[model samples]
Target chain A: MGNENRIVNGLLKLHIALCLLFIFAPIAGSFVFSLNSDRFPSLPLGEFSTEWYRLIWEDPLVWQGFANTVVVGLTVAVIATLLGFGGAYTDFRYNFTGKSFYLALAMLPPTIPVVIMGLAMLAFLSRVNLSGTTISVIIAHGVMCSPFAMAIIRLRLSQMDPDLEAASWNMGGNQWQTLRYVIIPFAKPAIFAALFITMAVSFDEFAVAWFVSGLNETLPVKILGFLQGQVSPRINAIGSLAFLSSMTLIILAQLLLRSPEDKKS
Target chain B: MKVNAEMEQQSEAIVKFDNVVKRFGNFTAVEKADFEIGRGEFLAIMGSSGCGKTTTLRMLAGLEDPTEGAIYLDGEKVNGKATWDRDTPMVWQSLALFPFLTVQENVEFALKMRGVGKEERRQRAEKWLEKMQITEFANRNINQLSGGQKQRVALARALVTEPKILLLDEPLSALDAHLKVRMQAVLSNLQKDLGITFVYVTHSMSEAFSMADRVVIMSRGQIEQIGTPEEIYREPYNRFVAEFLGSANIFDSVITGPSGSDGWKVDFEGGETSLSKDELPNAVQGQAVTFIVSAENMQLSAPDSGQPGILASVAGEEFIGGTAMVFLETETGHELKVQKSHDELSLLNLHAGSKVIVHWAPESCHILPGENL
Candidate 1:
């Protein structure tokens, strides 16, 4: 039994190590390429250079794409968090007919194959003449990010002591006051988590952005365009930046979610 | 005392439920509740779970709106009004203390919402905390306090607003037995000192009996009986009330014939018992009625003593310190319970399977009309 347990433990560790290597290998390669002094990222101790970073920083399209991505991502984050919180609150707080069906419908966006969703969104946008706009990217990303936001908010709402809201109301506070003071305050970490996670998702989102962004290319769309055209160490530099920022935002979300909600004495 | 009585005579009902009915979707939560809460009364609505006891209190607190009728607060109709506008506060069983707020902030939440200045809210909360004997924990968060302390904080928070009526939804039900008893005394004393109307909802009969001035017993969304605790304990209006209030030994007794001008002879199993007809004014001959006697009222005896009582043998015994509940199986196999004090039970030494007779005075029985057993 002891020998078998040791073998299992060794195997588990090896599996986890292999998974981590698989995930980080691309990011490590991207980072190395981003710093290579040569054009192609040739090996044999290539001298490190900040030239690609300087070029990307100097490029107008890169700056424009970066700003566009931030704007769209923040907008999506706000809409997704608010809509998600409202949907979760209504779904959890009251009973109504068709609740299950409505919930299932709301959650169908992400599972419907992103390419199909992008194509459908693109078709809708073009028909409405709203294609290629920043709002279009924001709209597409908002639809995709909301279900995830609702899921996290719903999880937090479920863990919440529901009477806290009731108590606030019972204490002669109106619905808005209770929501402001009690429900929202208690759900702060979850809301923050949702915000950061959704923003990261919006920033990293590409296929829908590619279809709808047109001339308003988000960072990911710009990177895709660069790869399709003539990829350089500069594209690697952009990938590395994407990897760093998304990881940072996700880690911030995890920190917020894991923050001690129950205050110590 | 005389002046206080004269003033009390002029006091009106603080909260009134006028033909209120609350329904969620198609299921009714509070059905046809029409009761007036006196200006300074501690009224407890007691029932088993799903009896709408808490729902009734929620209606008064404005947490639930009546689907049919109106609720009045201080003589003003408040139908379809939100809970916050009702001016009635609640101390929930969960305490519902904000995990993010300190004890002071929790106690001052209503005041803050009412737009009270910070200094004034702090002073008022401090005063309430002092009154509740939780002054030391004013700055501490809810998680830091023990169960009793948290309950005190909840009480303080509820009282800080000085609302004329306070609704408590089984606030002490979450506490341990000993803490519950202590909190019961604390709640009663606080209610008395403040002279505020309290509508307490609880499922524990003893808790309701010990603290409430009037106990309203509910069953299946309907008010079964509403009366003072003494009246309820001694004179339950129906079988449901009798059985729900206490450990009652109820048997199916049939009205056989008239014993006298106001009495009827009842036959149960193969035995004859006479009950006062005055107590059963509408009892008809050949009609089935439930015979009820509280476990405390019935006495146990040795079967060989030749007593004129129901013949039975002890089936089980449960002793709770000073009192013992003796369960007896009659010859007809109907189970009857007899409660006796420790000293009284000691002489009989009735263990399991002991032969005995269950005896109670005919007047001690509370008879309720029955359709079926």
Candidate 2:
């Protein structure tokens, strides 16, 4: 029995160590690279300093790109959530014609090649003379993020009891009233979850933004631009900061929207 | 209480279903059901599952629309109106309270939507919480309460709106047996004191019979019978109604002999019974028929002067609460149940395999012709 327990404990500790390494390896490597004075990322030894972090902050083009990314992420989150919510509500509540076809169409974004969607949008937008601006980038990001939002929110909506809405209606609530009072409140957690995930997707998206963004330079594209040179440690600083921002935002959103029982004591 | 009682009495019929028929694509749920509930009447729709009893209640509550009929509340046709417009509230089987909301907020939600003052809503909510014996749970989240406490909170929420009608869809079916009995009494007394129109749906006959002013029994999307509980139990219209309510002994027979102006002699299973034509209207000579007799009305041993009756052998004996059931197998291999008081059990001393003479008067048997039987 002692031998068995030792083996079991060893396996559990090994699994936890592997999990932590898998999560933090990339982050720690990027941080180390950002501080290394050696311009080449492959170099083993160099004088450590905060000069790269200062350079990242001083770059006006990087700040512009960061601002553009934030704006695009927020815009995409709102648009994708609205479209996904409409589609989910239609599929769940009503028996409209072509419901299955619409649902299938809604699922195309996550499965299709991002480059292909980006190329298709580019061709479509160029013909309409709307390529490369904030509108085009916003539309492309919204389309790319909607399927993920729909998937998350639909999961939450499906778990809800339909009778609760019926009870609201029986209590003298109209369709709008029932939606506002019962359905929306029950779906708030799902909406927040979808929002955070969509923001992450839009903020980190590169391939599609590379094609659709003409004049608008999001942070990811700017980082890609920096990679054309001799491995700038300033780019490493930017990557580390972006990773930290995403982790904090996601954890905060999850904490805010957790079920009542999971809230703090 | 007196002022509220007078107001309820003066209120008109709260809900009326006029031949409502609800069908799903090819299947019918409620087939032309008709009923009216007066104000402040605690009516129960009772049947086994899939009997359209719940569908009927849903129609009245406006949770569902009838495919082939109209519903009226306060003399207004509300067939197309949404549930919220009907001014009726529902207590669900799952107690569909907002889990995130405090008990007070959940109960006051409808009032808030109606634009009632915040202070007034809280005050009225406190009143309903007290009435439902849940005042201490007023500020707690719904998930924090126990099952019975949650049920009371849900009831308080539904009643706090003071809607013209309150619909309950199997609200107590999920409770444990002990809690069910307790809540049943609580609901019964609460409805009486509040004097609000209650349209309750349930599959349990005991639950329906205990509190309903009138019970509607449904079977296969049709109303089987509608009457007071006593009338329904005492005089069931057909075999389905009789069997669904509880127990009844059904016997197949064919009329044989007849009397001049008095009664006829019916032969059944090697025994002839002298039953008046008035007692057996469809008992034509040489015609098939069935007779129904309640178990409690059956006598174990006949008096020496009574008519000759069928002999039944005790197949099984069971002692119930304050009564005993003697399962009797007739000579023709049919089972007939006879219920007797505990004191009467000592006289009969019934056991399995015991031969007992089962007897009943002509008036006790409800005779049905073969076709209707």
Candidate 3:
């Protein structure tokens, strides 16, 4: 029995390791090639160099794309988190007709095929004369990211004692006061987690931004442009930097998403 | 003069519910609840789950508006008042302390909502923390506290604003037995010291009996009985109260006729008994009646003692504190229980399957007033 259990556990561990390797190996390869002083990504590595990083650092267009990405990511994160908090709190506090339909509609944007979503966004934004702009990218990304934020905060709110809100009211706190003092404070960890995760989502989104951002391209769109233009190691360098930043945001979110007690000062 | 004083006291009740009815769609949660909570009274509304005790407490707190009547707080009708507008604070069953806030902040929440200045809120919250004997843990988060400590924080938070009436909905239900008793004492003392009316809702009989000045027993969305603990225990209003109490041997009897000038003969499943006029007033012949004899009042003896009592065989014995409860089944299969001290039980030398006679004094039997005989 012990030997059989050991075999099963060993297989499970090997499976997980294989899955992680499959996900991270490409990013790791790009990182390694980014440091190599090769013109093209060939297997026999040249001497380790930061030449690609230096090239991207001096490119004015690269800097512009990076700035646009940061602004769009930050603005989308705030807007999505606020909308998500409102949606989650409504689901928590009220019972109404078509609630499930409302939630499904709110969560529908992310499930659509990104290519189709990009085309649809382009069609809709251009009709409003807002296409090919950073605002259009922010709007498109915000639509796709808010659902993720809502889901995270909804799970956190579901774990809350429903009586907490009523207890606040019973203690002479009005609805607004209770929202400010009790509901928001209890969901602070998940709210911060939602913010980070949504920011990362906006930062890494490419297809929709590619369709909408004509002149003010985000980093991902700019990276795609560079890939189409030339097979340079600078693409690998930029990819490695973007992957590192996205992973950092995700890891920070994961840490914040731990049980609220552990996050206390 | 005494009647006038009593009338004056009734008018000065801190809270009153007049013909209050609460319905959730087709289900009635509370039906025509009419009661008044006197100033500084410790009133406990107790029943099993879904008995509308919590609903009643919520209505009093202005969390739920009465469906058809008015609820008055401080002699003013507050039927449509929101919970925040009422000065009624409730300690919830789940404690409901703000998990993200420190203990002091959780207590100050009510004061802050009331727009109290920061220094005053801090001082008021600190006073409660000190009173609850949790001053050292004031800076700690709520989740960092133990069950008993969390209970104290909940109490302090609810009482921080010093409302005229405080509500508690089974706040100690999650505690262990020992901690429950300790919190009960703490709550009892706090109510007395503050001189504030407390409307406590609970399902535990011991909790209701031990701390409440007046106990309202509810069943099926209706108030079955309301009195002091001793009054309800000694003379239950109906069969439901007797069974709910679970400390009595209830017997359904039919009034045979008048035994003499002032006594009536009654026939039960076990045998026959007679009751004086005072024991069962206004008895009618052929009328079905119900009476209860508390476990402690029951007497047991050997079968051959020639006692005028029901013949039964012992079913089981349960030791409860300094006393033992002897369970018996009569020839008619009626289950009876007798509670006695260990010394008395030892003298009887009773065991399972042993033949015994179960009897009680005629005066010990109290006829249920709500039997509708």
**Tens digits of per-residue lDDT for model 2, B1-373:** 9978645634656666788889989999999887778888889999889988888877777778899888878767888787766677889988888865788989998887677899999999999999888898887877788899999888888888787678899999989999999999998998888888788899988899998999988999998888899988877877788778657776666777786677776667746566568756655788766667889988777334354567778898788899988888888887888899888877867677877788877678776432344
- Tens digits of per-residue lDDT for model 1 on A179-242? 8998888878889889999999999998999989999999999998888889688998998998
Give the TM-scores of the predictions, in the order they appear: 0.91, 0.91, 0.95
Error of 2 at B245 (Å): 2.3
RMSD of each: 3.7, 4.2, 2.4
lDDT of 2: 0.82
Cα-based lDDT for every prediction: 0.87, 0.82, 0.92
* DockQ of predictions, in order shown: 0.74, 0.62, 0.77
User: Which stretch of 10 consecutive residues in model 2 chain B shows the poorest summed lDDT?
Assistant: B302-311
Off by over 4 Å in 1: A229-231, A260-265, B1-10, B254-264, B277-289, B342-346, B369-373
Highest DockQ scorer: 3
Cα error, candidate 3, residue B144 (Å): 2.4
Model no. 2, DockQ: 0.62
Candidate 3: regions farther than 4 A off:
A1-14, B1-11, B279-281
**Going through the candidates in order, what is chain B's TM-score?**
0.92, 0.89, 0.95
Clashing pairs in 1: B262-B277, B263-B277
TM-score of chain B of 3: 0.95
Q: What is the interface root-mean-square deviation of candidate 2?
A: 1.7
